[model samples]
Target: MISLTPLKMLVLLFSCVLSGALGGYYAASFSPVPAQIAIVDVQALVKKAVEKNQAQTEDDAKALMTKVKSSTEELIQRGVVILDAQSVLTAPEEAYVNIE
Candidate 1:
């Protein structure tokens, strides 16, 4: 049998509202921005690399892999999310990037 006086009830309501406002502010402040996504045609990139470098020997393949890895890492460091072209069904033209 809890009996709340009007003043006590008002205080409780005020406390709840304050807590909710603070929580919302905290969440909004800490929320991450949506990442920009870029779709890459990995197969095309590989084909182009092979054609340019004549990737027949193991060393040539390794060099091609190194180049691809560096480029991907550079994009990631720039806060861009890279997705394989094949995995994406459809994307905006702006989402496609030429990594050549």
Candidate 2:
């Protein structure tokens, strides 16, 4: 037969309360912060994203401009070759095929 005297009952009750309190404290400490209640700098995040996108867009535009210039130059050279093909063929043959 286990008889809990006044002193033992007090100690048992105190231990249970202490253990429960410690457990609650540990659980609270380990709990994740709710997303809706979390702190964040929305403006700073948006600004950073905008800056990154702007820089990427500028770099893309530069690459596109370089490509366009190169393509334009190639087209111009082709046009010149097409326009001068007849003159270029006659120019080299005049001296080589000349019969005296």
Candidate 3:
């Protein structure tokens, strides 16, 4: 059987206590700070989305709407022709994604 001398036991106990205290000290020293910075404040930006529409004017919006309506009518006119000669491939031919 092995034995621990009293002095050796005292040294071992002290070493264990010292190791725990240092580990706790290091953990506290390296812990993260609780704060962050936002690049943009959305509430303020939404309030500024239109100081008065410049590039995208009321007339421009109307023109785009008319273009969309015309394109939609053309698609409806040729709906069956498009429905035939179909395959899994559509737009983005390399990637196959299920619309549903």
- Residue 22, candidate 1: Cα error in Å is 16
Name the candidate, 1 or 3, with the larger TM-score value.
1
User: How far out, in Å, is residue 73 in model 3?
Assistant: 63
Taken over the whole model, the C-alpha lDDT of each candidate is 0.82, 0.50, 0.47
Best by lDDT: 1
TM-score of every model versus the real structure: 0.49, 0.36, 0.32
Q: What is the C-alpha RMSD of each candidate to the true structure, in Å?
A: 7.6, 31.1, 21.3
Candidate 3 lDDT tens digits, 29-77 = 9998532211222223223444445456677556544554454454446
lDDT of 3 at 83: 22
- Which pairs of residues collide in candidate 3? none
Number of backbone collisions per candidate: 0, 0, 0
Best by TM-score: 1
Model 1 C-alpha lDDT per residue in residues 1-100, reported as the tens digit of each score: 9999999999999999999999999999999865488888887877886777673787866876677667778778988888989999998887877766
Model 1: residues >4 Å from true position, as ranges? 1-35, 52-55
lDDT of 2 at 9: 100
CA error at residue 94 for candidate 3, angstroms: 43
Ranking by lDDT: 1, 2, 3
What's the residue-level lDDT of 21 in candidate 2? 100
